[model samples]
Target: EPEVTQTPSHQVTQMGQEVILRCVPISNHLYFYWYRQILGQKVEFLVSFYNNEISEKSEIFDDQFSVERPDGSNFTLKIRSTKLEDSAMYFCASSERGVGELFFGEGSRLTVL
Candidate 1:
């Protein structure tokens, strides 16, 4: 079975820098989402994308953040300026339907200093 794959499983960056996290989900899945978990905090939703447009987003997805499906096969999340608070484990997920089980990738951990 195909699963979601994320690149650079671990990333270290300085505050004020930019970072792009990449993921590739199962080929037939439709709804894609980005979620994050701060070191000691609960998992939070960032944004959801479908049909090449943003379907839903949380307040955490602010001006500093953006998502894209540059190619049909991969999805990406870009943070324009990093902050210490931005350090978190970002997970990429996809589901065949909008309301079912979401298959997730091994999170990409971001560390900002």
Candidate 2:
């Protein structure tokens, strides 16, 4: 089965910079999501995208963050103006529909200094 995959397994960046994480979700899935976990914290939802628009988003997703499909095969998350508190493991996930199981990628770890 096709599963979600993420790139640049780890990213180390300086404060005030920008970072873009990439993901490829299962081709047949209809929902895509971005979630994050700060070092010892629980996973938090950032945003959900479906039908080319944002379906839902959490408070953690602020003006500094944006999500885009860009093209049919790729989904990306951009974080502008990095802050030290933004360091976390960002996960890319997808589901056949928004209600049930969600398949998650290994994640892209972001380290801000």
Candidate 3:
């Protein structure tokens, strides 16, 4: 069995700084997504990507945020500016089918100071 992998398991950054989170999904999966969970808060969907383009995005994925699949095997999320509200556990997930179960990566925790 394969799973999604995330880099920089933990990140500590000053407010207003830039941050990029990277993830690699299972080789055979197609649908990829980025989701976040603020401490003690519910997991929220940030964005979904397919066919190298954004398929869906939530209000949280504003102008300050962007995602890219720079290559066949990796997906990345970049935050132009860090805010206290942005501090959260970011999870990367992928699914073979568009509406089925999503295999998730161990979250990358971001702490904004």
Candidate 4:
């Protein structure tokens, strides 16, 4: 079966630096999303993209965060300026539609110091 792929499973960065996390979502899915979980908190939705634009973005998706589909299979998240609080497991997910249980990658762990 096809599955989501993430690169640099673990990333360590300094505060105020920029980082781009990469993901390859499931091949046949039409909707893509990014969610993050702090060490001990609930998973929160950051943004959802479809048709080459953002469909919905949560309040947490501020000016510093951006998402892009650089190519047919690659989806990326760029954090222009990281903060200590930005440390978390950044999860990439995709679904057949907007309302469904998403299939998630193991995740890209972001640690900012």
**What's each prediction's TM-score?**
0.97, 0.97, 0.97, 0.97
For model 4, residues 28-65, the per-residue Cα lDDT tens digits are: 89899999999999999999999999999999999999
The 10-residue segment with the lowest total lDDT in model 3: 94-103
How many Å off is the CA of 53 in candidate 1?
Answer: 0.5
Provide the lowest-lDDT 10-residue window in model 2.
Answer: 1-10
Model 3: pairs clashing at backbone N, Cα or C within 3 Å? none
Residue-level lDDT of model 3, residues 1-113, one tens digit each, is: 78899988999999999999999999998899999999999999999999999999999999999999999999999999999989999999998877879999999999999
List candidate 2 segments past 4 Å from native: none
Identify the runs in model 3 with alpha carbons over 4 angstroms from their true place. none
Model 2 score (lDDT): 0.95
Note the residue pairs that clash in candidate 2. none
Error of 2 at 112 (Å): 0.5
Name the lDDT value of residue 57 in candidate 1: 99
Candidate 4, poorest ten consecutive residues by summed lDDT? 94-103
User: Candidates 3 and 4: which is better by TM-score?
Assistant: 3
